[model samples]
Target: MMHRVAGAPLAFAALRSQLEVPGDFAPAVRAEAAQSAQTVELPPEDATDVPFVTIDPAGSRDLDQALHIAASGDGHLVSYAIADVAAFVRPGGEIDSEAHRRGETLYFPDTRVPLHPPELSEGAASLLPNQVRPAVLWRIELSGDGSVRSVDVRRAKVRSTAQLDYDGVQAGLDRGTLPDPIAALPDVGRARLALARKRHAINLALPEQSVTGDGAGGWVLALRTTLPVEQYNAEISLLTGMCAAQVMLDGGIGILRTVPPPDKGAVQSLRRAARALGISWPDGAPAGDVLDSVDRSDPRHVAFIEHAVALLRGSGYTPFNGAPPSQPLHSGIAAPYAHVTAPLRRLVDRYGSEICLALRAGIAVPDWVRVALPELPEEMQKADHLAHEVDRAVVDATEAWLLRDRVGDVFPAVVIDADERAGTVVLDSPAVRARCAGADLPVGERIQVRLVTADVDQREVRFERADSSQL
Candidate 1:
């Protein structure tokens, strides 16, 4: 059954206060924004001829990327324009220091703590439609078989023709009514996916749960499924990041988003869980392919994804000064990658993009950028930890709010993971995942569980095995 909460403040506000998230920008940061500075020396070359458009979630104001793809000699040409935040914020200035402190934007159901003040991140530096803006343009050329042939990055002035949300783009794709630039996406996106599989990229297609106001003074939790075009559009960003990593690696200096390859023991444990769940792993199949074969909507598949998280642990930012780091690969993407996208939201991307631009332009990297690289990994790592906790807390609080009134009700659930002390289970009705304390819980088997406790303030939900035959 669907659940609703009314006449109460969303727990996210309270949670944010508990976590000490800065609700407003510091006075210095705000005062600095009034005196906006421009840093680009050379005149930005005009690229407004391209019918570039922004694709993001509905109502997303702080847009980051815009693109136009076309047919090249054999494969395709992708002209991706990223917001030129570096051009707007002076290095080592008040805004720069504030952004470095924030690291990245933290999102929640009701509010967002932006990395930069709205006057810049959502205004001057933002790539909104019909507004001419400076951007870091990446003109990437791919071969006939989705192999990258060439890449060029430079400062340019561009104007977006349209600001499109993902839903609108998906609708256009479905009706076969998209313009040439948008229409050409499936061809390149499919090609890129093929290349990713060839390299064994593990792209988990997990459904995200989002809570929204239902317009009747209440909240509704919605599961947003990943769409084909969304995944394909992401591939373009991945391709650019891989190219950025290649440039930095050859230049012998940059921070890489690194993760070690999955441990043999972790993979073996997942294999055991799959067998017990009655799922087959084809003999000699790569991990990515085996993961792709399962249906994400199945409860057992969700369990499998949870188990696979163990293999993808130890993700971190590794900065190298003299030589490339020894562990340089982001095992999740099956490539050595640096974050050069989403500079408006992430602090590291601005530095990464500047390094790529300097290397491509044959100019010396700025002293400020060089000095900040080594210190970024630590601050970025801490911000990442906070972001993860905030996201989890918001979800937990929302789940607790939805189930607060259903304490004694029994619902069907599947045990996802188990131990002697406690086990994790997913309830069918409210679509909430929580813990269930019990004995002899069968993994991957449906059972009736009676809600034992639902504490809204504590952000907890607990259950125990029940006699389902009574239902």
Candidate 2:
């Protein structure tokens, strides 16, 4: 069942305006992007015969990475083709300056503020099927155990055989009818996941709350669970990123996506919550394993997973030159990582890819990249903050709209979090998570909650324990 809201577009527009989100490209930027799209040069190396396929959300036009995996002497060769935004966006050019200011794409429920003009992001530089586009191709050689043997990145002209989506790919895998180019995805993904677990990587299988357009001029708020194939696809990207981080570290200059180790206090809190929720977290078992072992469909397990999100709080971009940062690890991955796979949407990926390409080719890092390294962290942080705010606001507004007509009605909910005065609850139907106020609210237990206020204008939804308030 879907919970829908009418006139959501107006609210979204107001939110965008209030947040000062970038609206449209300047005339010069648009002209530059259009001209580059028409006259961009393709790389000399031809990888069109590799039969690469791209997997992303359905109807995604800004295609980023394409992949083709095949057997190689009891191992696997993963040919990953990333959109070469550098080919079209000259350093210090109009697109480059604008992308730096924006840092990354800002997504909304109704639309997105793209980092680059759609001419390049969605048309020319995108790795669309049947179109020969310039790409930064990573030829990753992995052993039978998913251990990396060698990594090579270079510019090339590539054509994707098909543009697949997560749902279709998952269905194909279940039916054993996936195409030859990506048939080994399951095996490779599993191997990489095993390696991740061995390293104590933290993988949270949390349900995503998203707002989508309803058929008629309204919006629907829904909860989505990650499919197995999606996790497999993510493993491939993570593999490429870890390899990129190693190359940059060896080369002695680049930025990294870093996170400090999870707080000791947070881990303890999660362990206690797990016990209260009746989830089996074995003695000394890493949180990731316990999370992976839970049944995601259960209310108590879902509540436990929600509490575990505290472990992923302090992620940020860490740029380094000549000397590495003191804390270089992304704690969740339990390894050093770089963002080099999605140049079409993110500003840093383009720079990170350039560093890897030059390092792999035994050349000096470009002067433009060196000049921009120190500033990237701040820019990306600003963008991250704005993106988070926009996402939260949209969800809040949608939740308010969903419950606007049902004020005073009661629903079954699981108290996922609690403190002295208030807490948070997750409703089973309509998939709403909102603030609740009551004395001594029980954590990790199912209870009845009464909707008190659903203020769409304020983008607030609040509830009280059903027994604490009288209708």
Candidate 3:
């Protein structure tokens, strides 16, 4: 189910150069990171006895989090440890200045532009298995119903007992051989999912298109479906973020990841699309509920889910000092959330983690952190924009390369979106989504589309309706 595209490496290299992506770290930053990696002191509090394990994609070096869950009475006790990037990067120091300039890690199919030098991000500061590293530990006690009863976060020295990947963990769970450290994940994850449904949170089960190496020096484009264990792991992270957001709100100062509620007009449009697609929408069901009911195996259902993506818009970081912002909820999550779980990859998480730790310890927020809060949102926004551009451009170019030899061939596709004269289509064979041009393209319907143009240099791929094309 994967298609190998030729000449992708050269095309991607040219694209990166054109984007002016940052290269290796500056010499001063590298030297500072190397020294700090060797000499940084571990926190006094030791949680190394806790058997924490990390779950991420295979071969991920810059690990950010490790977790262990256990039964606490009828509920569960979750011990989450996040990499403490601040331990090695001093305020206004070389590494810190370089990280601020980078904003966040930029990921491409071939490689990544790390936020910090490898000496720290991939070495000392990473939560690699058996390594005693500094961490921001979150100890959360949850009720039987999965509601958080109490939360605490602080610095500590911790060690990960194992490094797990999603596929392996899910396989272990399926065989009833999962380790004890995270055996409670399914129970807690199911409970939390019930709560999310009750709160009308949107959970889109859409397959993501990704490009990877084919091992023979070519690029393969494929669709990756989310495994059940991945959802459970994500729920744990969400719980911590919600807890952090509450702590910051109580302290009256911090930044929040916020999104406005879906617009009424957009909701109506989605309802109309559902009707056109022959999907049922009850009188009182929320969009999330309606989406959850759809069978993802159906092509029409996939198209409808793609259309619902429009409901999530206007998301941005909201920084506040004295009073909390008017809108603080991440509508997709149906709760207030903060970015404090991935400090190694994201610049904002380090600052957010520092604020939460200071508030919990009853100490004044550091002046350096306070002064940087206002500018953090803009910096993160720019980084986010760049990341999106890179991902989209890379995919577009790869898709173009995949279809370069079949410009006149017609392929079966689903019209996921439409306007008066143009729309978007998803082809299943190659797992590609690109712009389609024709008159009155039907949305959420299977149709034949002919590839008209596939230009790797421009990262453009276009199709025309088979019936409308003159050939």
Candidate 4:
């Protein structure tokens, strides 16, 4: 299902221009941003002494989440702080409208089109290390067994004690020498993951491809595995989102991130896929449990995980005012959830955090947040579509450029999917997936594939079965 014409441009300039992305802010947007720094009010709580630290990519400045975990009486207290984006952008202002138009931050290869102006999202609102920032703080208390005991949301002022990345944190954890204040992340994260599994949470195992500088005026696609501490860190955000959804449901007014359970047909298809791949998915085992047992480093298991991604679709934002929805589960997370973290990068989190705050404080939900609840679904859905398109386009373009001169080269590839017309094969060296015209391409089987075409202008690539191709 792909078309390729080699020797096109090696840069993303063509794709960015082709997509016609909004690359600059409007005059009105700029005007509002200049005033926001002075007009934006901060909350009246100073928790700077809590020793919170920002953990993100090595050089990332748009830090959205920071935390300080400690052992409380028979449990742990997780003081998770998220950037308070709503506090800076006034409702119906130019910044607000512009953010709605953008919906969310779009990250490309080397740059990003931020939802809000840099003054706020990156400079002021961001929780940079050692900087005092306003945040929507989640105070979650958990029992010894990792079950959540209570949750509280509030507006507060805080400062990050340090900025740490996953690799650094993992190294520290491995050596058992992380500073005392932040040493509790692994323990709490593992406990929370245990609770998630108890409720059937499904964590997909797939390597992600990232583009990095080649140091010669170009980029290279790198396939990286998700580190153990990274998953542990993500479990914190998941715990907060689940707590947010529960609060919204109990308060009877908010939006939720929802995904319906997989249907009988999807499950049947997955079972068939597993059998075709010669993977034994036990008859009565839950899909999550079966998936957790596979070694992801194996190509066959990668193909199985690829098929598993299809079972977790139909995701969307659902808003209600007077009552909770009957089916509000986010099947991927295996729990009810909402977007209450990463407000600096996302829009829904700002409104959801506001609603949760109001509900926690026994105050009326803000009129502005109430009005935006129903409208957020459409906005977020559209933004999500654009983000996905950009992501796919960038990857396709990069793959084409990387393979431009190797059209006749043969490589080992595993079959990810197959249909009557063609089968999708993934090459390990470049870590790119391309559809190859073939027959009897058994799913998950490793075979020789030759690159037939790679076109950067069209951002397409096609392959052929090297077993019988015109070598």
Candidate 5:
């Protein structure tokens, strides 16, 4: 049930301390940030010919990428420019060592510890609104069939025409008055939508959850999914990143983000669950195929998606100096992938961009980059976990705070997951996922429940079935 808790702070003091960013890094980092801000040269302030716009959450200062799209001889050409973190952080320098130690930017509910200091990350390096900045750019051509025809990567100076947020772009698309550069969104969106549907045809469609701040020291948990435009924009980034990973892998060098494919046992378990829920499966068909036939609106489907999410567990950073992992495919994107789009926030992107830069130049990869490459996977893994842990701790605490006042409220909810003993239910009225107990869940069943208790300090929401059947 949705209820509000007032007067409680959303941010947790202990988690913030645990996620404590080494704001007091070596003196070299400060000097480098200051030097970086001063010596950096921006491109012509008047190079406004390209209709590039920065798309990010509203109030996002550490913008990492800017994009522009245009028609190119019966195909579409997209130019993406990412902040060039490599250009500034010298090899093995203080900032480099510190960033290597941290791996990535850490985000929390109330604050963020940038991988690079604001003077760089959110300031000079960011492709901020109306600012000309140095960038490593990727230009890609896609045929009508959504296949890549060619790719170009280089260093360039560019300026953003405007800053746009996701919902604004979605609203513009819905209104049919999108700006010219983004008018292609709907077309590309449809193509990407088809691509996702195809993947679903062969894979599970998982329901992922993202937590949002409620402005009053609490959180509103939202069931996030690949919105049409979100998926469309992501495809462009993914294609480019995949191309970069391919080029690197083919060259016998570079780090790739990988997650092992799901096991047959899990697939079988999902199949049994599907049969229990009355969903049809083709003879000897894969779990992915069965998922495609299910109705997402049904509570059973939500449960299936949550279970499917387990298939993507244990994703990590993988580095290689020629021989790729035994498995190169990223099951989520259904392609091998690398991090190349957000140099401003990710240390590995700086190295990936450098590799792409060198590959484009037809030069041997720089000794500095090659030497530093071996250590990146671990550093990046630590950073990734730290960032995620901070975000998770904050959101969990905030959700607990928000529900603290609604102990007796009841709301409609659907079962989204079940184990041998307990399960989870997602409240339908508002954006919240809560824990359900007792043996009555039945995995995919829908039922009403009262908020038995909400403990902000404990960071949990306990629910009971509204029906007297529990009694």
Candidate 6:
């Protein structure tokens, strides 16, 4: 089942109009920000001194996480300093209410509505390089096989020494001459890389595209996770988040980003899809595991991954105010998980971090967090819907524009979805699903087809069989 439904018709102009502040829309999170807007005293820059760097987009204002690696007793320890948004925004205050209402930072190709105001998100709480800021640090110890041995989270102040981008990191990692700190920790990097390959061996290989700021005129659609280091860095964050979730759940209360296991019927459908694509599977393995293996080995794995995407459906925000719920873990991550990082971009993380902090301190979970727990699910759902709509609209529009003039051109495409009765086929690249125009197309098959028509104005692309020579 396709759980990610088609987006509603909410135009960018309308959402922009709604997000406009009312001239005095909670200028700062508190009066302290107003008092020393010029030169506020900040935390020590020891973290920044140790070659801590930020790895985000080209022109991101609110940097959320920074990393620093140092030698430990036997191995290396990773100090991950995340922006402490929970400290700045008071619970139930005006700014807090606004953040809660917003629920998350919604990003579109043309516009973005940040979760917190710029003074805090882009200034005080941001982990900008060379600027010391308060941070909630997670110190994790990693074994040689990439297993996390010990984990610690606490309130601390830190700075980021350098800011790095994905492209730069990829280039450095490839050339084997990365800058000082990142280059110094070869074992840590190797462990992280090994861990990433281990994860990809089991996790679903889904592709993601991010619309980046073009800087000159508009935005450009770029596929994320193309580089190996992208996956490596993501695994670090995931390790921390899973550890935090475990800490909270073990203490008897915590919210989870939960997705129920794929249904047996859904798994069976995927298995049939594999057979249709001429891929073999073991006798009694789990569907997810089989799909992961096929994705790694099969030539048509791109299309197969698309089909496997349908198996895991309906992910949602589940709050555990009183006790943790009995549910299967997220099959994609291959572990139980929750969102504790990126508090600057997400509202739930602020409260979630507070819960974790209190639990670690052996104190009762704050009443504010407990009382706000039930409302979190619905709020997060709304924000998620809004974000998805924005993303799909932008990508759909861009692809339509790119293919507007090449209507009759033929290109190799991996089949994402197909319907025999409707004569429909969806391509993986450009993500345009269209009708086959009077013929049946098999699902999970790859072929070259001509674009019969493309209407950029209508956001529609149509396809047909090309000549024998071309096909």
- Which portions of model 1 miss their true places by more than 4 Å? 1-3, 37-42, 468-470
TM-score of each: 0.96, 0.97, 0.98, 0.96, 0.90, 0.84
Clashing pairs in 4: none
The lDDT leader among the candidates is: 3
Best-performing candidate as measured by TM-score = 3
By lDDT, is 1 or 6 better?
1
Could you give me the TM-score of model 5 versus the true structure? 0.90
Candidate 3 Cα RMSD after full superposition onto the native fold (Å)? 1.4
- Give the Cα lDDT of each candidate: 0.85, 0.91, 0.91, 0.85, 0.74, 0.69
RMSD (Cα, Å) for all candidates, in order, is: 1.8, 1.5, 1.4, 2.8, 3.0, 5.3
Q: Select the stronger candidate by TM-score from 2 and 6.
A: 2
Each prediction's number of clashing residue pairs: 0, 0, 0, 0, 2, 0
Residue 350 Cα positional deviation in candidate 5, in Å, after optimal superposition: 1.3
The full ranking of all candidates by lDDT, starting with the best, is: 3, 2, 4, 1, 5, 6
After TM-score superposition, what is the CA distance of residue 207 in candidate 1 from its true location, in Å? 1.4
Candidates 2 and 3 compared: the better one by lDDT is: 3
TM-score of 4: 0.96
Question: Tens digit of lDDT per residue, candidate 2, span 205-317?
Answer: 77788898887888888888889899889999999999999998988999999988989999999999988878888888988888878887787887788888999888999
Model 2 regions lying over 4 Å from their true place: 6-10, 468-471
Cα lDDT of model 5 by residue, 1-471, tens digit? 234335545545566665675555566687888897888765433334677888787789999888887877766888888887776777877777777777778776456677887788878888887777888888888776566789888888888888888888888878898888777866765665466456643345454555556677655556665555666677777777888988788778887878777787777777777777777778876555566667877877767766777667668777788677788767776678899998878888888888888888788988998888778888888888887777666656766776777788887778877666567888875556778765657777767778887876666778876767533
- Residue 408, model 2: Cα distance from true site in angstroms: 1.1
- By the lDDT metric, which is better: model 2 or model 6? 2
Pairs of residues at least 3 apart in sequence or in different chains that clash in candidate 6: none
Model 6 alpha-carbon drift over 4 Å, by segment: 1-50, 183-202, 210-225, 294-299, 405-412, 422-439, 448-458, 464-471
Badly placed stretches (over 4 Å) of model 4 are: 1-9, 468-471
Tens digits of lDDT, candidate 4, 339-438: 9898888889889999999999999999999988889999999999998988888888788887888898998888888887689998867778889988
